[model samples]
Target: MPALGIDIGGSSIKLALIDHHAPITIAASDHYNQPSPDQLTAHLARAATRLPIPPDITAIGICLPGIMAPDGIRIERSVNLPALQGTNLPDLIAHVTTSPAPRRIFTDAHAAAFGYWSEHPLPDRLFALSLGTGVGACVLDNGQQLLVTARSSGHFGQIDVGPCDDPQPIGPDGGHNSLEAYIGLPALHARYGSALAGHLTTLTAADPPLRALVRALRIAHAIYRPQHIALLGGLGLQLAPHRDAIKAAVDEHLTCIADPAWSLHTAESSHHAAIGAARLASA
Candidate 1:
């Protein structure tokens, strides 16, 4: 039987059905952009009902970009989608699905990393960085996710290396190039809006986002010592053309280790999180 996986993020929602049998395959899939919780829930219900083999959906997995209550039913805080805060996602989902399939939930980063791990079972310790509305990461050791409870995720976006004089506010600010500001759409737009088409024509070593990304990768390599580091999400994939450039930047900055052990790869699957959800549910 296949299990259903749903991934809710800051800007998009995606769902897929995965058969965790001999050859894992996606049986069905769908996506929506920036839908409210109620609208998104109804769409999922409808999508599940219309599946070619609806009965094949024996279990369901949900991944969200926020904190969940201990009971696992309520979303205590949806960081990007504020409306989902203090709402019970599963109960809302149950209101729509006909069979009320057994369900599992995961954080977005954790789910994406898990999905990648399922597809490529190479290195035991891996780090997955999800970059879009925000940058986040998840660490997996021997296929097991760590820091997955309510507020324990590896929020790498907030990681600061500077020595501050006083407590500085963290978030989007145009003065300095924070990781999120450079990668997030709003900041990127604000910085390059005047020359949107002009800037993209020639992305070089000067791009702050690209530089910050390289720095982040070096830091990750030092800390996690992961065998592989996978990058996913809208903006993350957009940076694919500059993969070689990013590598060069890393080499220039890395002092202690000439070449890091981890191999960097861009995650290409649109159904990654959903696939991960289904895999976990089947397990």
Candidate 2:
């Protein structure tokens, strides 16, 4: 049976029907700009009514950019979407579905990592960085997520990568010299005004985000020694065309423990989190 996946981000919300059988496939999908909490609740209600399959029979997976309670029922904090803070996302989704369909929640980064890992299983150890409104990271070892509880996979965005005196921007988390401060949407917007999308392709190893990303990838390699490192999310996928350059930059000054065959990759689609959410629920 196909499961439903919902990914709520700082600027958008997406839904997908995922058939994760022998050959995974997305049967259907939808998206909308982020809206008020009440509007989102109404939208889910309408979506439930219009779904091609009954909610009662479908498993639902939801992911959000925030810190969740240990049981995965409530949001402890949401830096991007303050309106969702303290909200019981699972209950809200269930209220709209009004059915017995099992539901699960995940941190957006972890979901994206699992989604990417599902497609590329050869790499026993996979590390993924999600760059969007905020930055998130996750690691999958042999298809099992590590250090994940309460929807936490460790805050990769908060790691200080810049000099203390560097007067660059900071993300919502207010972690000075943090990775997110260097590459998050707000920082990129500050660096490249309205032409951000066009500018992603032109970024080089010496550029702001890429430079910071290389530093972060080096840190990831030293710690995790992942066989594959995936760049994912809204902004991450933009680096797809320049993968070779980014990989070369990371390969420079490489860590001794890093995998010799470690490779860089991008998610096949921006909807990976939503699809991953469904995959998580099914599991």
Candidate 3:
């Protein structure tokens, strides 16, 4: 049987058909950028119709960008794509497909963690951090139990570091301190008073503060105390420029273990949510 994975994000949706028999052969792949909820549904339906082995697909997995409770009904607070709030995504997709294949919806971070764990299956405990417009985290225990949190449990960006007040401002003067304040793309641009893209390029080449920012993330591992940590997403991968610095920082902050091996895995595709969704379906 094959599995269909779909990752829904603020800007794009990614789809893939994976053959369980031959996991290496991704039968079909597609993506749609910035489509409305209804449009996205329609596109997925069309994709389903065109899949090479539609009847063989055992399940469909969807990685959503908001809070999804265990009931699979209520969607809470999708900051990037607000339209998803309160939307029952499983029903919507089922209605669109009109197919009996099972479906599963997972938080984007959880899905990424699943994808990572599927590859590296031995860790007794693992923490996954996704860095992009914001930070998302997921934790796995004994390679089975997924610790889902209502609050920003793995939201690395929400961690407070310095005295710059809150990174995001609410109402008027109420600010909140989060890692996003210093490391987010927008904050970085604002701090430099320049375009984020240009600043990112320059930072990649040589920026002492940026290097320190990378080190700070590694230091976070000490507080969490997971057996291993995996970094995901584009921004997380970019931190590789300062990997040695980060390792040094981690060693300096950590006391429990002499030297911990923190594994870094870049997102295999921009559509990780979609890939994760498909994996969910297969599972």
Candidate 4:
């Protein structure tokens, strides 16, 4: 038996078959891009047909970028993908996965953190920042998600980190000079142009986005005191090569409560959320 893991993004859906025997192993995987709201079910069906999904799926884990209802069946809001608001995702997925097993829902950040923690379990408290289309963060305390607010496990991106030169704020929340306004994809593109990815190696504390990110990391240290802080997702993967520089910058204005040995890492898997969803469902 194996479980199905689906990670729905604003424009893409990533699927993975996680082996029940080996929770962390991905047996199969597929990616569908730019699916409109109406096309989601169709793409899911295509994934089911293309991937060799087992009939006896132990569970299914679905994660997305949103604030989930307490029951986890309905999405209350998704700033990056408003179309998903109030959508009954499990019902839509039921059309493709005709399983009687439980369907678990997870916030994308929580899934990424759990997935990263599953692979690296030593740190009892882990803080993970996901830098992608939008920024998100998750803190896991002894393998359980630590909810910072009533609606979200971690709303780290919405916090105002510093002022920006842009006339308008960059995130959907309309918060001025939020952390997302500094390092989010759209913000990065606006700041560095189309060749931004190519110029990541040249970024340092002098760069506005990197400087804001370091400030956010320092804030995380003061708040969570996490033993491990992981940087993951599209932008995070790109910044992996410059981990030392980023870490050094974060340490420059480090808080006294922050652990001197607190480590930073870039999650190796591109599909961390999907893998985490399936692994968590298996639990």
Residue-level lDDT of model 2, residues 1-283, one tens digit each, is: 7787777777666666766453444332234444677766665566555545444447888888777777667788888777677788755676445556788777898888887777678558888999888899998887788885454567898888885225766667877789988888878887899998888878888887888888988998987788988999978778888899989988987977888888888867887887788888888
lDDT of 1 by residue, 28-147 (tens): 224454567677666656655554435547888888777787887778876566657788875656643555678877777777878878878755678788886667788888788767
- For candidate 4, which ten residues in a row score worst on lDDT? 25-34
RMSD, each candidate, Å? 4.3, 2.9, 4.6, 2.7
lDDT of 1 at 265: 73
Model 1 per-residue lDDT at 96: 33
Q: Tell me how far the alpha carbon of residue 82 in candidate 2 is from the true structure, in angstroms, after superposition.
A: 1.2
lDDT of each: 0.67, 0.77, 0.58, 0.78
- For model 4, name the residue pairs that clash: none
TM-score of 4: 0.88
lDDT of 1 at 101: 79
Clashes of 4: 0
- Using TM-score as the yardstick, the better of models 2 and 4 is 4
Q: In candidate 1, what residue range of length 10 has the lowest lDDT sum?
A: 161-170
Error of 2 at 120 (Å): 2.0
Which stretches of model 4 miss by more than 4 angstroms? Answer: 22-35, 40-43, 69-72, 164-168
Please, what are the lDDT tens digits per residue for candidate 3 over residues 41-89? 6665665555454665678877766777567677766765666777786
